[model samples]
Target: MAHFTLKQLKYFVCVVESQSIAEASRQLHISQPSISVAIKGLEDVFNQQLLVRHHAQGVSISANGRRVYERAKELLRLSNELEQDSREEDELVAGTISIGCFESAAPLYMPRLVAGFKRLCPGVSIQLHDGEQHELMHGLHRGRFDLAFLYDLELESTIVKEALNAPHKPYALLPADHHLARQPFVTLAQLAREPMILLDAVPSKSYFVDIFTQAGLSPTIAYSSPSIEMVRCMVGQGLGFSVLVTRPRTSVTYDGQQLVQLDILDDMPDSALIMAYLRNNQPTRATRLFMDYCRTVELAAVTPLAASA
Candidate 1:
């Protein structure tokens, strides 16, 4: 019998993360119908309904689908690393590594890391792919990414996790004219009165939820959106303030919009950026070198003064 191919595994993982054909297609740079066909082909091979579809609500994985997802992920990871492993060991210092990321780190950190890594390892190349938490995780598991920057995910037996840096102080991104903008930094308690923007229902989303829960108040949320830019734009437009893990990059205009900083009542959450890769997968020399770069980068300590830069 013809077995599943790596291409099929990738499509499965993408759909699982995106939960919709159209979204996955757009992300993978494939046509929607092609993504649909790949998924149906996998279902036929497994002889089970890997995905359960709801017309309006989108798609979700079935119990059986989860099992396939986990195993296919490991296999994909193995295949991705195999080529890297075979390259000349020292030559491994040269080549490219793919990363799965989010707006949380991409805006500010990536530039610094890339520049620092380039200076140190002149031959290395980096490719970054950005998405939300679920999408990032799915790409990591599917072996499409050599590594990723993710929140502290509860990892599985076949994956390795390394903590990089703690989450920055959570702050309210507000319109420059908002009342809270007048203060240098406001406390979490003061934020209670304002309507806010927050993330959706996911592990990382729940983490943010807990931050508010611990504060002993539910937010007056007037807006909820998945895209980081949308959330920032909404908050910048005076729609509402946002409690986000990442701080604003600098005092600059975004799409001709202005943003102000508001202080939080509490310290930032204890969340950290982690480097995740398959445990059993043997990364190439390039991947290993990249991993070392992630661990050792000397990020200048960011403070309110640093934030203004």
Candidate 2:
């Protein structure tokens, strides 16, 4: 069967709102019998009773009728909205862009970036998704995201990468009393004999380990945790120590325990954070607008600092 006509739904709404066929006919600019015939035709197609008539009281909608009326109104509203949205998108006044986010980037980088983008591009819509490095990269590869932030992205031959922030140098997290804590910076050789807490979820752990290997120091992993918070908490308690490249200032603590930021004396890690996009995939205007904004606000050149540990 053909879909119900928009006219039928409009006529139904009028009848329901007026609660009388004669009034509906007057408002709809049609005869009462014509309205009655359309209503009867709809009820027949639905195979359910809708309006019931009483002598002087006009018509009252049944339960099923009320449900259909509500749905029809929603459909009509949505249809109008769809037309308006199409018009805006065609004019580049409104559109949607999806972005992929890495764990560290979203926490420290994206909050301000998004707010700024919205101010410049008020008509565009942004969709945000947060995930680990590999997960975010996968989304970018699959075209699931228009733009993405990934860390230490060892690129294939076809991807584009741009430096977004300063290279985050890894530092040894140690208690204030530890002998290594006295130095302005710590080297891999200095902490080689000590136990270390490794954060499994950190994408840069392997790179940091490689930095140690090149320096001829083998770290002994005394504890392992998947959560960054657990790693910080363990480091604070002096259970063990770890090397972190990118950490929020809020996580750096000068309170409970005396901690030192020992700069790695070994060869620094090569993985620098970057904003990447597929080389072959042409970006939409909205995507380009957002990318430009990240580059703009980032002109202040935010540098990573070591506060405590």
Candidate 3:
């Protein structure tokens, strides 16, 4: 008979996912020796070498460990579901939901979304991870994130997405004093000829570049950055113009320089913000409630700073 606690399985999963006992310890707030003993106990019970320890580097799962890890994850998930199921009759929903958000959209929406959701389910805890589209998708596959808030771009078919809001149109951004700033709207041809500050994050880079390519034009890239704020700051400095989907409430950059938002004269495909998750993995009760809350919120509301094209 296998006698092991869920805590042991949790510690083992954390070590494998984090790839470092030290890291798992920090995340779980447990001591290294305790985690080591837990893993050793599991190894002893099974009479197998589960991990290949590389001194000072990290541990890698052996063949048996890989199988055990998958089962452990499923078991942990079932355990969580069982707990939630038992509390279904209660008015208070309590559990943790891990979410991954796109870096560009996190600042604009996460703070409000998280806060609002907490008000409805005060007993629930939320964990947020913000990164590029690729990173978020990877986190989903690895079971690190229960849900992901990101743009509907270049996603695999296995990812199930629920549209969170109406499609958002991409618009041109420029310094307040740029040559084209006086115009109410700008065309791709007009902007293509000028220096472009590209938002170089994955899927975003290809999406922006494709916008010009589809119109038989190519932007003259003067600067490219993964950070949206950095791209905005460069535009504010009049280094180049940029096209972005999400608009901050203020038109001012972090450096306090002003920017002008202009409509795109040409019709383009709109970007939709979506709640994504793995199709095979069912969302927890708390996650489903948060998802429902997200659907009711005005997630697509942006300041009407730009004029009609």
Where model 2 places Cα greater than 4 Å from the true spot, the runs are 1-93, 251-259, 299-309
lDDT values of the candidates?
Answer: 0.72, 0.70, 0.90
Q: What would the TM-scores of all predictions be?
A: 0.66, 0.63, 0.96
What are the per-model C-alpha RMSD values against the true structure?
A: 6.2, 14.2, 2.1
- Candidate 1 lDDT for residue 73: 73
How good is model 2 by TM-score?
0.63
Task: Output the number of the TM-score-best candidate.
Answer: 3
Better of 2 and 3 by lDDT: 3
Cα displacement (Å) at residue 256, model 3 = 0.4
lDDT of 3 by residue, 1-309 (tens): 878889999999999989999999999999999999999999988898889899999999999999999899899888888887789887668888999999998988999999999998898899998999988998898788999999988889998899877447899999988889998799999999999999998889999988999999989999999999999999999899999988887788889788888889998887888998899999989899999999999876566454223
Worst 10 residues of 1 by lDDT: 300-309
Worst lDDT run of 10 residues, candidate 3, spans 300-309
lDDT for each residue of candidate 2 in 1-309, tens digit (9 for 90 to 100): 835677787788778877899889987799988888888888988987889887888999999998888787666545544644566655744566778877645756777788888888788777788887777776666555667777654556566777775445676777556667778777677787888888676475576567778777798888977656667677777877788755555434434554555666777655666778778665666677677777766432333343353
Among all windows of 10 consecutive residues in model 2, the one with the lowest summed lDDT is 298-307
**Which model scores highest in lDDT?**
3
